[model samples]
Target chain A: MEKNNNHDRFFRELLSDSSREMPFSDFEDEVMAEIRMEYEKKFSGRRNIRLSWLFFILGMLSGIATVFVMSFYSANQPFAFISDNLLPVGIVFICLTIILFAEKLVKISFRRDNH
Target chain B: MDELYIKKVLDGDIDAFRYFVHQYKDKAYNLAFSVLKNEFDARDAVQEAYIIAFRKLGKFRGRSKFSTWFFRIVINEALKSSKKAGKEKYIADTRTESVDPGHVEINDIVSRDQQKYYIDLAMQNIPSKEALALTLFYIEEYSVEEIREITGWTESNTKVLLHRARKSMYHELNVLLSTEKKTLY
Candidate 1:
């Protein structure tokens, strides 16, 4: 639904053509390998997206586990709620939500600065 | 991930570089061909693009996908190569060139009609930047936002360029195509 026009179709075709695929040749392999090697060294200074996604996935798993444990405790220990992990889980949810929101601050540049 | 090969290279292997070269040279060349439309320039442009990308790989934060960043680098290289080579020329010499049935060969692919191939050809003789803009938007199908990133134009600027570029392509393409179709074919 987002892209349902001739132009969209046109762009799709064009995008497919733009990929860096070519006939197999010794030269092609050499260039790809060379660039990859060169980048791996230079990209060492910062955690690349691949590495960042790894951490994000770990965070997601931890948060999921935390939520599950806290939810079970809240339902089972309805009377001794203070001892339940619910509060901590709630706090974690709030904190992590804010942190994720904060990470999106830079992306707001695409927004029209109405000022 | 080239995985084991990357591991060896990281461990200070020089032969690994050769393997790297073996892997992506043709891909890089094809990228050039897509944009520059010339085999010789595309080959050189890809080689040059790879070298520049290699040199600046440290700066690549992977804010975008790896291939997207690499594509940007190659596009820049092709643009630069076009400038040095001057406007590219096109020929419709019906002499034993490959063509698919019902797919008209417009010298300039941006022309409105598929009839006059020369119109597309004429586009090749114009400014490389404009030509590239048309090709990217129409042929490569990059979004205006994506074009903004690739060409370093703001969103509004990209929109304006695309509008003007399309108009120009249509005008140029029609000049050759429309009249011929009405009179000749």
Candidate 2:
């Protein structure tokens, strides 16, 4: 139809017209900043993981060394001594629990922050 | 040109990736805008797409032009954002009428400026896929093969989409302009 032709001509003209440039200045800087920040965040996460693993290994070794030293000192009755000092033993157990949970808490917080 | 930046990026130079982003920002924004019809969403989509492309750079494999690979990412992000924003409702409503230019009524002396406005408005209403294809074709002057690459559609599918888009845009513009005239006069 004539109307269709008219409309097609109009569309052709509209499309043929040059589009205005996107109104963004310093977009590259913003994106670069974001990418940089992302890398830093990733690097920090990996560093934290390594640190956590190192701390874990160190804690396990210290625990083993404390047991060895305690057994050597109380070779005659290590179990009886430990039972006799339930308060100190309980405190040590609590501290270990706190440390383990604190590490887990930090990991959870990091995951939350990233997401 | 972009391949050089991509290579540099692959070599662990993060800053070099900026060159590719700077080069394609405008075209990417335009393509996103063509689908989203919202400036802020389009901008966000481009940014997110670029970040995704940067992270996924290792998988690029150089099988296609960097531009094509980048464009596919941008268009996919824009579509996801568009869907999330519920703009697809407008597109669906506008796509109802099969382009029947015979139904249009155009006065002989319509202004170019007016036509341009209606054209833009109509563009916002068409199906997102068609609008995206037409945008790439007209604004970027991309070849059909390039559009096919960008859209991940077959060559025949891309051509058919463009044809449908052209017809749909023509009819939508006529209808929109006629409605505007009725309201104005």
- Which candidate number has the best TM-score? 2
Distance (Å) between predicted and true CA of B112, model 1?
Answer: 14
Question: Model 2: runs farther than 4 Å from truth?
Answer: A1-13, A18-20, A70-74, A78-115, B90-108, B154-157, B179-185
Per residue, candidate 2 scores C-alpha lDDT tens digits across A1-115 of 6765565455555676536456888778888988888767767877777787777667767766776666556556646676457546855785787587677857755663341
Per-residue CA lDDT of candidate 1, range B19-90, in tens? 545555655555466457776777777776766755654455657754567667887888777667764444
Docking class of 1: incorrect
For model 1 chain A, the run of ten residues with the poorest summed lDDT = A106-115
Can you write out model 2's per-residue Cα lDDT over B109-183, one digit (the tens) per residue? 366776667667877878888888888877787888888888889999987877788767766766686677788
Reference-based lDDT, each prediction: 0.56, 0.76
What does the lDDT read for residue A35 in candidate 1? 62
